[model samples]
Target chain A: MYITWMLAEGHTYKQMLPTTPGVFMGEMIVVTVVGADKPGIVAAISSVLAEAKANIVDISMTVLRGFFSMIMVVDISGAVTDLTDLRDRLERKGDEVGVKVMVLHEDVFRYMQKI
Target chain B: MTKYDASELAEIIEMLSFQHLDIRAVTMGINITGALRYDDLGEGVREIVEKHARGLRDAVKEVSSKLGVQIVTKRVAVTPVSVLLDAKAGDLNEAVRLGVSVAEALDSAAADLGVDYVGGYAAFVESGYSLGDRGVMESIPEALSSTERVTAMVNAASTLSGINMDAVYEMGSIVKETANLTGGRGCTRLGVFANAPEGTPFVPGAYHGRGEEDPVINVAVSGPGVIENVVRSLEDADLRTLHDAMKRAAFKVTRLGELVGREVANRLGVKFGSVDLSLAPSPAVGDSVADVLRAMGVEEPGAPGSVLALAVLTDAVKKGGAMATSSVGGLSGAFIPVSEDLGMAEAVRKGSLTLSSLEAMAAVCSTGLDMIVLPGDVEEHVIAAIIGDVMALGIVLDKSLGVRLIPVPGAREGDEVDFGGLLGKAPVMPVGRFSSKALVMRGGVVPPTVSRLMKG
Candidate 1:
């Protein structure tokens, strides 16, 4: 743990550890990938998020007869990139990989499914 | 512990992105009854703008951002202005001027607050027009045409009051005059209703009724595509199984409404009014009530089994929605607006859905003749007769119904016109070029039916 100072406006100012540049942070979001069944779909999706410094917390993928479907819960709080930027970049990557990608905040899932 | 798991998350994402699950509108109904007590109209308008406009845009933005679900429309429904104009004389010129001025004030306030539509520039005359009702009625055309955001309605009939043919006849000409003024666009802002409710969040039919004494939040839920997808998946579902499937789907949709609506109201410090579980459609392919009807065995929306399918769909939705939330009001059924629903538009293009068929469908569903564009040459009296026929249906069956017909200028039958955006693109449907001049000319109030007398 690093020393942190509390500011008047309720924001934290943290001093960095000697070796690490960015602190470990997480923001849970659901990502859905759907397209024709093919190889390298997972790698194609993960590479874009990974390049943006997003962490894949959980993932599931399956092929239904011919079409492929993948769902991932990722943490992007550690990324320097904004959520909107990462979403657009991932969508562009999906277009190249011949799949449809959708990224939504995890609250949508929690609100709809549980209660 | 968090509420949803992996499977539920995937399902929600699919419905949201592809199946068109969304919150249609969060209409905040504010009571402007006290405004009438003020001597000056400007003072009244000032008080209203002050009370309602503050922190509205910020509240909506904050709630929408916090929830992550899009609150697509923000609207305000004020108490009917006709009540305020009642103390004045029924002079037509004065009425129009007052209408335009009041509308300008409301429109400016709404624009300032970043609200989309300001409803309840309306008058109710189910039996006969009061002096103020007459004043507001005569000014509706000028009022609606002059304002950008203010929408209005006239309840020409109700279950107890029966059909007011006199008011219906007047509205027909008002509709025609409004269409002329705005090139068939202003009519979109007007709604003529039978048995209109006080809590409908959707416009132009929404108004803060006399029954409501305080501010309230009404939520209109959207998701025809999700139910359509579910119905399509169950290819072999019988009527019983289909009903069950729809109930289950509606339950989920309305639950989302309840959750989001209550949170929004709580954040805004207003009372949570109701979750109107209407499967409202937009121009998008997947977000169509007609598509849901198609999935329920109707090859076309106005075909033989269309009414039955609509009945089943409407009943199942009401049941599910009622169970999901304690307070459910408004037109809580599937909307069959031609331009708004892609499937319905296609049905019109294929020549399967006719104007008469739409009237028949409206008898079972929520609104009548909504977003249907007619040829430019259609007679004004014929338009009134169309409304008259629908009003008659409402009187007999005792259900809420309305008409939002647009007689496009210079457009003939089968010629497509694009209003663009959520108003969508629509092909002009034929209105048969018939004249109802004599019927409209002899307009007297249609007396209450035997059903009205039977209420013991």
Candidate 2:
């Protein structure tokens, strides 16, 4: 169950706070969310990641041909949960909000993309 | 700072999931020339084993975990065993035994360290055969047959020294003898090169040259399938657009290679060598340089426009790869190895790609007659002539080229030979029935080109 709240910027977010503290420090994961173009999707995803103390190091989101897509490199060093556990929490939020979420180690994106 | 938006991110995902994009090989070049002086050969082998044991294992673990990508094949290339034969002092039989023992030790050590292949069981006789070169040359047949992972190469031709037809002829016979000894398996591990590079990271040809550092890390990045997908998506795009897009793709691929290579080198405390951007293909369907060529509007590889297409593709890849990394080396061009490339194999199977056309492509591309399977009845002289022809191209163009032909014993023309995995499969193609016995039997070196002598 997700509780919704509105910010001063006229954006809505879900409350999915981290349940634990300091779970694998100095690690990162790449998160990608893709689904129908809709409001509150970014807010929902960011809220979940922030609640888990995952710092977004890099992010690129764009809507193409009426479909919403986003890719974020998040430092999960201070995460309160294991990577897969955090991914599971994000997936639940994704399910509730009607989007697809994929979580993988940041190295995957780094190996395929950056130098 | 490297921001990949939706489309670019999708491209990476799709390439990895469907197109089979991955690092082909991360070959570590180790200089074992210093190992030759030990009274007991076992001491040299132990030194090699100890040096590589922790370094390679730790790097592989950390890189795979941190980068979240497979390193694919872990390989080792050492100094050519021909140089080590100096210790044997003109004893051919004793050198052969020593070569076998050294190769077995190296192979066992490599296997123990979880390496895929160990190269540099080689003879460098581009000008003329030295005693040590001859010893290693004679031992190649047994050495390769006796070991699982040892790769051998013979540099029988180079631009400066011209073609050593004498060594070339012997290599042809040695190739046949190796096949006979190992039932065509050994020939796959042996390559004949002209102008072989000092920093090559790819197998059957890579060796720790005398000029290189004590130990270095070289990475070979491959993504023929990725390039194919990118090219195919732009249907009816102009040639310039196609070339530009392919360049962009290669730049990204090579960047990733440089990143991984540097990180691995830093962790292992060895200098980073080069990122080889050869579009090496596998047996898989979409992962072929021929597929990329086909996407460039060639109906089939080895067709009339195929050579030009390959030239453009090879040049564009180099331009992109050059911009991506400073230390780019090895055979950095599109490879049309027949057996290893699915589309090339299909082209051969359909009778669209012929031996002559493949040679023509090799003239413009990197290696020549790579992984081509020929009929068992093909004479030794004919094979020598084939190597001579490719060597002449490398000699004239002053570029690196190699030939890896497997004459499948008992297989006739149109017969299929399967070596499995990266060795892939090829259909035995017919060579000219005519023999060049007299020419090969000349057993003399072709002098350096006039251009070579003119270099003051």
Candidate 3:
């Protein structure tokens, strides 16, 4: 069963997992967006992920000193596409929205941040 | 919960985008000992290397794309070519011919496999030379000159076995001969080592030693720019604070290597070897190790406090890297190769980084006197003395060190020569006019250090 969630900003992964246990069982990718604050940034990025059927397990966004930053934890195991194609789509979407988007496997953050 | 803040994510992004942080090399160590069983040595070696290195580049690319981290180079390291020559070579001429043929095969296979460099044209003769060792020593110049993408190393000293001055003396002439043969480019592909590590991923020294897995993936991580950025951000911070910051940065950088190495190995179905903690620098502006020293308040790389600064940096990197991965096996320290580092080359041109100071720094750093260019007419014995000095340090201090000296043909002191691409460019530094011929000529072996006899 493919499930997609648009969790509220600042919602932690732990908070969402219990609500829909085993629904987030997929390869998690970290998508970071950074650029000047602008309207509709979230809509544009979410559209691209929606087309690929990737689930947004968690998201956090903030604007500091006129610069916008957002981190999206996505589950791509149920997506129809691989990481490379998803990255290409997200990058093209980034170009359209004037933000620098980076799509990285969640393991990079886990390995570096944890131990 | 694995919690990560916005700042941590931002830091990783900045490192990848601006700090030039990347896995420097993913070298696959292939055991080629079985090649000697075949009648045709060169063909046997070619088939083995081809079979092992077939999918290495694709594997690296796939992992790099999946992780979104840049992998700069992919390489292969095979068993020492000298091992095959041991059974095949009947004399010096036969050794030279066989070595060149094998080197050509390695080069062709590397090109076909899309590998950057193929290492392990090597001989280990710390105490003395075997017939094959002598043959390899004699064949180095011709082998290096005849082949591109083939790197060679000779281990002439070790803590337990002492220094082999005979091979050291011969290597001097080999460097000169290679310089004359390849217009000094071949010398860049050769190194003389003391305590050369078995699983080093760095070229000119990487070789698959005995007891290693059939084919293993060993990663060398590059992060001088990352460390330099850390030091810069901590403006006016105390040395201890700066060290802590650099160590944290190293932890993250090494984690990247570990992730990339494991993924690449998993995809290739090979064992993951080790992540060399060495902060390998490139010719890029911000990526230089000298710049890292300068960022840490050293006026120039060879200035008075340079050694102390380098010591702190090397120690911090080792500490942080050791914590990050249990598999740390190569020359796990900082590298300050002159030509390959923009700031180090600039320091030489400014007359601030002298060869003498580089040797002193080598005592505390990884490798020794790397990619240093000398005047063409410099005597062979003087080169021998330079190598002997570093060899002594490696033995006495019981560390891994190596020398890659290039005596460029028709080039004089202060004259700049470019070796293109990753080899970079450098000015021909002046050597002592006084001869060390007398000392190097009276060579047999420097006895093992007293530390070797100490109770374990």
Winning model by DockQ = 3
At residue B228, candidate 2 shows an lDDT of 90
For all the predictions, what are the DockQ values?
Answer: 0.19, 0.24, 0.38
DockQ for candidate 3: 0.38
Per residue, candidate 1 scores C-alpha lDDT tens digits across B317-350 of 8888878788888988879999988999999999
- What C-alpha lDDT do the candidate models reach, one value each? 0.80, 0.81, 0.88
User: Candidate 2's residue-wise lDDT over B67-105, tens digit each?
Assistant: 545567888888888788766555877777778788888
User: Scored by Cα lDDT, where does model 1 land?
Assistant: 0.80
The candidate, 1 or 2, that scores higher on TM-score is 2
Model 1 misplacement above 4 A: A1-111, B2-5, B37-43, B88-92, B433-436
Reference-based lDDT, residue A95, model 2: 94
Best by lDDT: 3
lDDT, model 2: 0.81
User: Top TM-score: which candidate number?
Assistant: 3
For candidate 2, what is the interface RMSD?
6.7
lDDT of 1 at B290: 89
